[model samples]
Structures are given as structure tokens and as C-alpha cells.
Target: MIKTAFALSFALSTCMVLPALGAEQFQCPLPSNPNDPAKLEQIRGLLPDVNTMKNIERLNATIATLRRDGVSKSLMIDHLVGAYCLMVVREAPLTEAEKAALVRRFTGQVTRLVYSLESGLDIIINVPLTPDVVDAVNSVAEKQGLSGPAWIAMTIDDALQQQRTTSPPELPAGFSSSC
Candidate 1:
């Protein structure tokens, strides 16, 4: 009787644990083709913020330019995904909701860019905007009385700098620069 009870308990525990383990497994599917906007949107729905969204948009634009310049779609997608990972790592912790928002935005933008590239869309303009790329774009946009890539770039740069400031920097031996 005790053996029977033990077996039942073990079975139940295994069943419960399996689902929990599965739940923790996040399998992000890379689109089969770079032009599948829908698939990209699905992936983007996992990120955290507006700045991330903007960065993804800028990246998409850049990728589109690269595609026009003869880069392959697969390579472009790989590069974008790599860039996304870099940005996420560089940025700090985010709430669940923020992360979700970022994912959604990134997925959508990536999808669109992929589709555009696949369709052989012409590169309208290339804006090399980074979180640091903002200042130049902003200065020009401001003078022309329009918001441009610089605005987002500057915003990201400021936020990232603020993050850097809040966190203590690691000092090297014999480095006497003020913190």
C-alpha cells in the first residue's frame, strides 16, 4: 500500500514539474524568411520599451539600406538580432510590462523591414542613427523644425548615460580619473 502511494505521488510531482520546466523554456523562433513581417512582429512583442522600439526601427531602416547595397536578407536578420541582443544587455533591468512592450515594437519593425527587403524595396534614405547617433540627426532636424532620428538617438544616449552614471564604474589600477 505504501509503495502504491509513493508511486502516485511521484507521478503527480513529475507531471507538475514538467509543465513548470516547459513554461520556463522560451524558444524564440527566427523567421524562415527575412521578409515575413508577421513573424517579426511576433518576435518583437517580447521587448520592453519605447526606446527599444525606436532602436529597432532605426535598425530596420539600416538593414533595408544594407539589403539595397547587396547584403543578403538572412545576414541582415542575423545582424539585427545580434544588435537587439546587444542593446538588451547594455540596457538594465525592466519590468515585465516594459519588456513585453519592447518585444512587440521590435517584432513589428523587424517584420516590416524584412518584408521590405524581400520585396527589393529601394533604400529611400540611410540614417545612421545610434543611441549616440542622435545628436547630429537632432541638430539638423531641429534646424529644419522637424523631429528626426537624433531625437530618439539623444534620448537613448541620455538614458544610457544616466544608467552609466548611476552604476559605479570599475576603476583600473593606477587610474586616477574622478568617478
Candidate 2:
């Protein structure tokens, strides 16, 4: 009986340790092209680590700024999509369907690029938009249209505020919000 208990405890400990051992190391997959060093630097600076939710919020804010500055939707989407693809390629091996889902999931940012050849041609050819993209679409969909970028930023801020208020955490001071 004691031996069985020890074996169970050892199994439980191994299971807990496995996930921590497998946690991915995040790296920005910014392009190396020097033709537009500033743009590349900005992209690199903006890329998020896997562990940080703040990076996602920061991307939304940046999109808001770009929209305010009158950057075209297509242009912004193109750059963001490219960056997203690079990130996916760098992080993990995904099936094409998974890649499309990732694009759908993080449309404002193309978080994954390389996908399995088996999923479909669309995943290969199409660029997926992030939530920011959804914001852009919604903006254009409106008759008097709120600016897409502004809409995205506001939406993200509201969501973050909501998250903070609804589920207060146990640690990290200043993490809570009244919103």
C-alpha cells in the first residue's frame, strides 16, 4: 500500500513538472530587411512574447494610432498579417486548418505562418485579419463609421478593464481596476 502511494505521488509530480518543462520560449519574428529599418524596428518592438497579454493590447493601441494617422486598412493589414505569419512559423508547427483558425483567432495580428500542406489552399494563399481587422470591417460597415483604430483601442481598453474587475487576482499589486 505504501509503495502504491509513493508511485502515485511520483506520477503526480512528474505530470506537474512536464508542462513547465515544455513552456515555449517566445521570440519576435521580425523581418531582417534593412530597406525600411525604422518600420522593421517598429514591428520588432511591437511583437508580443507568448507569456504577455499586454502585447496584444499594445498591438491594438498601435493599430488605433495608425488608423488615426490615416494609414490605409489594406496596408496595415498586410504588414500585420505578414508579422503574424512569421510569428506562427517561428513558434510552432501547425496544420493548415489550425493556421487559418489562428488567423481567425488573432486576425489583427498574424500569429502563425507556416501550416501543414494538407489543410487547404486557402490557408496557404489568404491572410487572416485580427480583432483589429474586425474593428476595421465594423468601422467601414457603419454609415457614419467610427475610425477603425479608435474603435479597436476603445474596445480593447474596455475589455481589459472588464477582465480586471470581474476576476481579481491574488498577487501582483496594482493589477486590479475599478472598471
Candidate 3:
């Protein structure tokens, strides 16, 4: 279980990078619903194979980049899962014990960070977009045969990915804020 803030950060990496237990958010199971799993799978497919040490280091480096960018903890975890574990749960034939560990891995990390006020089943955030943006999302959603909500979720993930790639690395040590 996670103990300190350091442990909390380490947990994020291990949940995807070190785990035999693959995770979904909120300590939940890998989704059985085709709609969401399909979404997860799409993100999953877009990532490099994370089964190697170099890829693990690459993902950990991404966390460092996001941290420097001052992203929220939830967004960090979301990206970690998307970048590493989504492909895992889909492709690996895990045992029952492994699945249970998956549940524990996320639950432990989440327990250290948040208190739940809603059912895990309905754990979601409502984001408000401009009407024109909504119309564009809707048009694209319809063309792809995806529900509006699902497409929006996909778009958010895409935006997060863009943010991840574009965030600049840390400045050199001599570039002091002490001016």
C-alpha cells in the first residue's frame, strides 16, 4: 500500500509498469462494456509496446514531464494507465489472482489520494465545451458511429496525449528563477 507522497507517485508507475495486475481507474475491473473497452483499446493500440525496460523508462519519463507541467494527479494516473496497462488487460490472459491484484493495485493508489463520494459505477466528470465544439464533436461522433459521450472522452484523451508530447522538458539548472 502507498504510504507517502513518494510512494503515491511510485504506485502510479508500478500499477502499469511493474504490475502483473493490470488496472482500470477507480480500482475497477478492466471494462467488459464494448464501448469503453473499445475506447481503451484504441488508446492502447496507439502506444508502443510497453513490455520492455526502455519503454518502461520512457513512460516514467513521461510522468516526469507531466509533473513538471503541473498536471493533476488524476490526469497523470489516467495517462499512465492509457500508456501502459490498457493494452495489457486486453492482451494478457490473466488468472483470477492476477485480476484481484489489479483491483488492489488501483484501489491502494486511489485510497491514498481520494475519498469516494459517488458510486464507482458512475465515477465521471462533466466537462463543458463550447457549442460549436460540441457540434463538431457530434458530427464526428455520428460519422464514426460513436455516442457523443464516448467520442468526447476519446477527444479528451487525445488532447491529453497532445499535451504530453508537447510539454517542454525541465530548464537547465543555471536558468534560475532567482533573477
Candidate 4:
């Protein structure tokens, strides 16, 4: 099973969703990193007072631009999910019912977002293989206690490493890499 970045997502979403003003529930008094208090404070201070429909429209447009500019799906989804949370939270303060609704709406999307990003955003390929090829892959993967997809990923990574090490790097005259 793939894991979601819900912990990070929730923290970020909560921070973006509500105005810091008069919102004791939304405030993070103590920075998570004592050494990075400045950074944390900067982040806290930056959450927008986005209470208007126009702001939501602008945010959505920006998200679309990011997608077009080849931003990672995980990041795009993170902001998209955060924006959604912000809209919902602005509709009402942080109540148990509101939180539950947010979770219900976003849980699956977040899970998929994390899984795709973690997997390098590679489209899953279901290759049509001969019986011999299937048997070969299944045999090796089973020996290593891996699923077929996991084994394929590992094998590709191993092959890439081998290629990198075996291939000579182009160097200037009188220069050589020690790597």
C-alpha cells in the first residue's frame, strides 16, 4: 500500500485555510524547528486573508499555470488541495463536521497524489509479455519478496547505475574526474 503525505498536507492546508487573526486554533505558537523559528514565522505570516471569491478564482488560475509549466503533480495537488481546504474552512471555522467533510473529499486525491509522486510520476505500464518473460520476472521478483512493479523499478535503477559507472564521462584535456 502506498502512503500519503497527509501529515504534511494537513499542516500546510490548515495554515492556508484560515486567517491567523483571532484564530487561536490555527496558530502555531511554537515552531516545529527551534533552529528555524524565523522561517516558520515567515511562513505563518504569509498565509493570506483569502476570504473573497475573486481570490479563489485567482488561486485556481495560478494552479493551472503551474500545471502547464510542468510542475510536479504532487506539488500541484498539494496546492490544489490546500486551496480547497481554505475555501471550505473559510465557509465555516474549524469544526469537527467541517474537518470530516474535508477529509472525505480529499483523502483519496491526496493518496493518489503521494503515490504518483513517490513512484517518480511514471505511468504504470502493463506490458503484454510472452509466457517465458512472465515466468522469468515472476520467478526473480518472488525470490526477492517483491511485487512485479517493485522488482521492475529496482531492476531499472540497477541497470541505470551500471550504465553510469561503465560509461566514460567526457572531460577536458588534462582533466579527469575522480568520481
Top candidate on lDDT is: 3
User: Please, what are the lDDT tens digits per residue for candidate 4 over residues 1-179?
Assistant: 11122232234344333334454443212222346444333322333433322354554454455556664444444444444444445555566455534533442333232333343666776767768766766665544334455545545543444456699666899887775
Native-referenced Cα lDDT, model 3: 0.45
Better of 1 and 4 by TM-score: 1
TM-score of 4: 0.31
Q: Rank the candidates by lDDT, best first.
A: 3, 1, 4, 2
Greater TM-score among 2 and 3 belongs to: 2
Candidate 1 lDDT over 1-179, as tens digits, reads: 32443343343222211112325332233433547564444334533333655566556556656666664444454445534543443445654344434544454355345544244564445645456545654543343222553233323333444457599776799998767
Q: Residue 7 deviation, candidate 4, in Å? A: 13
Clash pairs, candidate 3, are none
lDDT of 3 at 140: 51
RMSD of each: 22.9, 23.1, 17.1, 12.6
lDDT of 2 by residue, 1-179 (tens): 32443343343223211113334543222332335555544654566743222465676665666567664443354455445555654546664445444533453232111111213553322436667756544543231123333333333333454466698656678666555
Give candidate 1 misplaced runs (Cα > 4 Å): 1-52, 55-57, 96-101, 117-179
Model 3 lDDT-worst window of ten: 109-118
The lDDT of each candidate is 0.44, 0.42, 0.45, 0.44
What TM-score, computed on C-alpha atoms, does each candidate reach? Answer: 0.33, 0.34, 0.29, 0.31
Query: What tens digits encode model 3's per-residue C-alpha lDDT throughout 1-179?
Result: 11332233333334333334343422332322334455454444544563422454554454455557664545545544543444445545765456445534433333222222324685588877779767866665544334456544544544455567799556797796455
Cα displacement (Å) at residue 173, model 2:
61
